[model samples]
Target: MASDGSPSRDTPEKQKRKKKQKQRVEDDEEGRSSDGAEVRLDDDDDDDADEEKRLEKFAEEDIQRLTAAGHAALQSGDNHAAVKHFRSAYSYASKLGTRRVSKTCALNLGAAYVEAGNAEKGLRVLQRQGSSGRVADLQFNLGTALEALADAMEFEEAVRSLLRAGESYSSSGNPTEAALALRDAGKVMLQCGRDSSEEILNVLTNSLELSMRITHSETRGRILNTLGLLFSQMSLSSEAVECFQQALPLLSGNTQTLAVVLQNLGATHNTLGEFQKALSYHKEAAQLYGSLGRRAAQGRCFSNLGFALMELAEIEEARESYTHSLLAFKDSVCEALGAIRLQMREPEKAVVHFQEALGLLSRCQDVSSSVQERLVNKLSEALQHKLILQQRKAVAQRRHSQRLPGAAMRRPDVLIGRREMMNSGGNTHDRNQVSTEFHSEEPEKEDYSNTLPEANRNLNNTHDETDTGQQVISSQPENGPGEPSVECGKQMNGTLPLVSGTVTPPPGRHKATPPQRTLKSRFCTVM
Candidate 1:
């Protein structure tokens, strides 16, 4: 008896019909296999055969015409037209009940959909065809579609699709294709940066071993580059450098690819503090990019070159390189200029450069918060420097006034007059009174020993009283040996904090100025 109030016989009859339908579907799928095997059927299969024959009679010609049109449209880059034709062809093949033709049409239709940027539809079509165990090409096409989808940011599904492709290719005895799919899957794993490190390593190891056995240099080079990037992410810089270098010769025929390897090598060397080697590689890359007429790429190379030069303390050359980079593209070079000027102790100039950098950032549509924060911090540092300079200037002026000699000491007449007034005293009490009056009338000399300490203490107190923004520039003295002493911030226990970063002018000092060039000639050279 059935759970519903229906007859049990009806349920049994329905199950029998479902069983027949299942068997027919199984037969159709088996017939679709690329390996041609004889079809087996039940005793009552004549009706099924007759039905399939009639469907084929009506749909066969239509499928052929539609498939041809689809191919033609795809070849001509009419992806929409190609998709339409392929869909019609697949529909006809499905109606005809020709399983092999239907599967082929499905593959073509999916590829067309993918070409038309309808990755979702393409994935669906390929998934439907790929459930059958022996469709290696279908799996391969699915992997291609998945990679395209991944390019469109469908990452998770792309990983699964590539893994399926790798498995399918391996089963079909194509090690190279299998390795290629696995390699791409490993790349996605790296990009995801999930906790699948062991799985990614296994995929990459398998791909690498298989790739080594193949004679495809381009593929091997690409694999090596991927490995290099992976190592870079892992902070294994030496190994990354080796991999990038090994990939270089293999990729030499491809200019764009070779330039990328060169740039990567340059960046890796820069990270390792090998500035000279980095400079050489960056210069070569810049030349290559120039030859290719890729302005943005050339600008990037110039910017990298500037970074290496700045690390080497070649500030002037770095500044020039940064200027060239700016002409090509606006970037972080203005901030770099601020840092350079700050290092040179030119606070006013640094402040100007920082303001320029901040203004540039304000105009950008996609400014990152971290970059803005860094620039703001830099500006704060510059302002603090300016304050320190002002404080030091005041202290210097006070020291200058204390050091100046009175003209009375230099004049013989004034000295003689003072001596006569003391010598020609009327009495002992009168002489003592006269000396006391002279001493009281003259200005008392300040004890200069405590001057530096008092100035530094005042400066420190002022700094401490300022807001959080001023604290970005450290006012605390460095405790380490060989650390450069900061003005107004050095240890001031008993000994005075030495006021540094200033040169005392010699007696009768005159500033030496360089000859200036005309604006027209300088502009011409810069241009």
Candidate 2:
């Protein structure tokens, strides 16, 4: 012990025994400390495992509670509240490390954002969660977000997203959603007004095909009706009618929808010139609208009914229908009524109606200049017709007053004498001289010369055209054998030249050839 380090505590033998005892004591203390540490470590591990399970259970419950609230909020139309609840659910699910529930919550969050009109936010949420897989619901919500962003996106991008959504739904056995997505795509194309008709048709047709798989009659009917309207806008009247007819029976339980289908059918049939069918459909639609207390819609239906009746030539029925429209509401039907009146030759009534329409239009803020211009033109036309009719009446009244009883009695005898002279082999010169003497002698006879000039002047002042392509005011009286008679106020090159209202001789008597004037009857119809 004293060899180099420290002083010895005991002798060699006794010290050996004492050293063994101290070593034993040190070993016992070390073993006891190790055993205590092991026991504490085991207790800590068990507590942590139990705590993690408890936290996971709480997180799952919270996620479920939040998801339920989000769904309830969405159904109640509180999209903002839905977004809040869904966002919390998503956070809880993420914290719990649940991939499946996390995805579900993400989808809910995105849909809530979309419904809230925050499409950009929804799109970002969906894109983040959609990276893992191709999900039908996810794709559908993504498409909706894209469609809502249509104003901010190019047409091609908007359409491509919708198509992808539709395809995904189709592959995932969700025909209804697929159909809706495709239908939306078709609507986008139409609204863009840039796609070809054929392309739009193909897209709509695919939607229709998918819609046929739907078991719910009302939903299918609505889809079909929407497609029908799109077809109508594309000018596919035949296909549109077919679609409307198919939807009519399916949607019979829904009164408003049924009425709309009937109205559409009526309009399409009218466009196809099937006025008889159109009249029936319009009547049914009008009655439905009346029952529904939709006064404005009923008025529109009656107006459409009037158009159909007019096309069928049922003038009285058409007029009655138009009156019904006017009673329901004072709309553009006034102009239509004016047109009908014009067709019936009631120029005074037409003028009144036209003026009323112009006044009504003036009061409306949305009236276009072109519409006002057309109404003004119609009023001018009615006025011109009224003036012509007044002139004719005045001329007829003057002629009636100027006629003498003696001249009327002598007219037959004069005509009989002229006929006898002509039948008795009179020479051309003698016949002409007799005609001249007869005309010169009968000064009291109906002298058209005085009234003709005024009538011709009035005719020349108006810009109206006859159906014959020329406005013939009056015919010239028969002239002598050497002179040729000419028609008065006939138009050449569609232009009416001013004349002195006097009959002029032809350039060459014997060889004079007059232009052939064909008299045609003109008929006016409602627009």
Candidate 3:
């Protein structure tokens, strides 16, 4: 202070100048503090903007990854893994702020929950999502899940679940399922004293129109085929035929579906009693099934065709067709029976087919007592036919044995005593092999011309010599009244029995009567 009084090193002017400089330094420090605060605030705002963009990018990537994982898990048939990813996706979408993404994730999560047997949780999630907006697919799945759990619910509630399921499926691009659901609905609705045809038609129409919007030909064909079946059941044959035809054109490109359509067409034709046309359709169906590599389906088609042909009196053809069917449908007794019926034309083979069919049908515990009765009756009839055929063959063989060149007199195939001999009550000749033939010899070398009875030589060749197991078809002296003038040589070539024979059948033998039309077989819905 004393030095400053004299302004030690300076006067008052120097001291004032130092104070002013100090004040200037203080002011600059204050300005720096304010400017630094403003700059820092601006920088913080820029960082926040950049961080928001990066968060959005990260959120999008998370969603995409979650979706991919969920889909992969589904493809691997791991429902639990899919559920985890779906849940993660839901959480990520919620945080990321996209309502659409969040809803879809929740829907997938619900489906996974259902697949995991967590039905209640899935229902809650789905209901919540549905309340917020609409997702036809999600609703359909939930309703279907609910329907499958009907046993756990009240009867009324279970029925309602089915009803809802039908509605949901209809709106979800699943027309076939929708129609089936509708059919079930109709059955249920009938219990309430209501006809569901009108309602069913409405659903059916909508389903058809909706199916046209999709690109999956298989799905569309299935829907169309289902509609055809449904309509057929309703007795709308024409409509059903149209639907099946529509499906046919589309399904022709797919072997499996084409076979199905052909089968449906055959069924419709059969219902209309267009037997020939039905056989044609069924034959085509069988071929189509073969092309599609379905042995069972081919067998079924052939069986149906055989049944149709039999009714049309094409027994020989029916037998061949049934034989073809039996080769493929080895497990089905019905198919075996069909083959047996075919063999009915050649009664010799009937017994074998009938016995095989009976053995198989016996194994099926689900077979109804009525079906068993029918099978037994058919088997009995086939056995009876076999017996008659055996008896006829035996009688014919005995007569043939008697007719040879120098054999003893027994029954003659050609009854000379009667244009109507007392044949009606006559018994068949007993088979006798007491080889008795008289041969004439030459007289003192003045031999007769050598015309060694050709018939005798042939008989000798048949009865005694050949090492080969070749069969002999000799003249069975029974060529009917208008016998052809062929010699014994052509007799080796067996001729078909003449239907216009005046040859009377034996007393108790069943004759070839016309086909017996069934009076009242149990009726089917014929759908």
Candidate 4:
């Protein structure tokens, strides 16, 4: 190295010193003094440290600002905007190595993704960054997102996610969330319809225990209801009844909840072959639903009530309940009947019912999108069945036409073909017209109960409590009785067959009459 009491500029040492001097000069210029002179650079190391600290602090401030913006967006229901903000916050907080901020931002990001319906993405975000003190909240959010994803059809994944959520919540000491998650898991397991009975029982048991510890009556009621349903599924009628009874008292404050409890109670009693009790429960539920202005729920209660009535052999009353409930559940009714008719080898009647159902469904605007889709799918199946029937009929007709020797050739052939086409077209037109006409009328106001036998009419007018504990109450008729009542036949499936005037029995069997006990139809469950 060359030197003038120092290393030469060409040497590595001299070159390093020159670079340092240039950097100091640049730094000094960057922070110039008032007199246009370079500032003293005594603590270069300290300045670098200060600069790094400032950068970290700025990053933290940005994360805070972003997180705040995300919350504001979430509160406004602008999920997409919230997701964007949270994503940015998460990135900044992560880069700065701030665990608390990063975790919070990540949680926010996942929830925003879920709210935006990007469930898979949300689940991924939570899974990666969700193992912290707030595990309970994160897992709950994850489970909910998975649920949404599963509804889009990833059932196994959703089940696993919900189980994970329950465990996480339990570990985090949040029994309430843990119980809810476990309950959801049981529901999902039940939906799968597999042999997961033991798992379901375990989860439901844990859920029940946790729910009992909570002070919330509604939550307790819901847990008890779910347990009752599970018990019913297992055919443990006594246990189911006990659970339902326990739930009923807790759910009294909420009309809809009380109605649901009553309906379940009715269902349980029906399963136990207690028709009268089931009828009583269903009637109470229907009245509650009516008071709450829940027509759909009321309709369901009526349909269930019809089932109890049929079991009790109250055919006339059952028919009336079925008709009333049909206003809301026509698609289900038609679909069931169409399927039954198809099974019975009555293709033509099945096709007619299916077509009528579709036409009526086209006018229904109050159903949920999911229900509408299901109805449309049923209609499609019905159309396919109708097509198959038509094809079979055409084939049979062609075979018959072939068997009849065509001596007159083209003339007879043309006449037969034309007639077949005309008949088919006419039938279709008639069915469509029937559908249109039926739709035009207010079906809810129509009462077919007037057609009951005179004996049945008396049964309707005065409450009858026989040894069988049957009860009946009649409402004011819209147009009074349409036709004069008839005397009933003996052994008419526990109903009096309609004929004119007084009741009479068959030769061998005696007429067994029950004592009248007039009670209002709308009896309260609480009373």
Q: Best-fitting candidate, measured by lDDT?
A: 2
Against the correct fold, how does model 4 do in TM-score?
Answer: 0.50
If scored against the real structure, what TM-score would every candidate get?
A: 0.47, 0.55, 0.49, 0.50
Q: lDDT of each prediction vs. the true structure?
A: 0.58, 0.63, 0.51, 0.59
lDDT of 2 by residue, 1-527 (tens): 67777886676999888886776677688875425657789999999999999999888888888888876666565769978998998888888887878888887788778778898898899889855344756666666677667663555666776788789879888777677778767867876777898998999999999989988887678777767766766667788789889988998997777877787787677767787988788889888766654443555567778877877789898888766665544534566567667667788998998798777656543233545666677788678667656755754764664476676767776667657756786655764564465457448543222211112322322234422211111112211110111212212232122121222221111222334221110001111
Off by over 4 Å in 1: 1-77, 140-157, 171-173, 234-236, 330-527
1 or 4, greater by lDDT: 4
Cα lDDT tens digits, model 1, 331-408, are 345655666676677989988977887787675432335455656776886787676676567557655654568654
Model 3: residue 75 alpha-carbon error in angstroms = 3.8
- Sort by lDDT, best first: 2, 4, 1, 3
State in Å the error of residue 363, model 3: 22
Instruction: Report the C-alpha lDDT of model 3 over 1-527, residue by residue, as the tens digit.
Output: 46458543667999998987876677687875425657789999999999998997888788778877876665565768977988897898889787777777777777677666676777677768754333444534455445434443422343454456557656665555454444334333322323466875665565566556546565566566655554554556677677777777776676555766787677666555667777777888877655543444555567667767877898898887776655544533343444335343454464565466566656533233433444455556556555555655766875676678755553443454422333653433321211111012113331111111111322222133222111121111111111111121111111111111011111111224323211100000100
- Candidate 3 local distance difference test against the native: 0.51
- After superposing candidate 4, which stretches have Cα over 4 Å from the reference? 1-78, 151-161, 193-195, 230-239, 327-527
Strongest candidate by TM-score: 2
Model 4, residue 102: what's the lDDT? Answer: 75
Instruction: Mark the 10 consecutive residues where model 1 has the least summed lDDT.
Output: 518-527
Residue 468's C-alpha lDDT in candidate 4? 25
Candidate 2 lDDT trough over 10 residues, lowest sum: 518-527
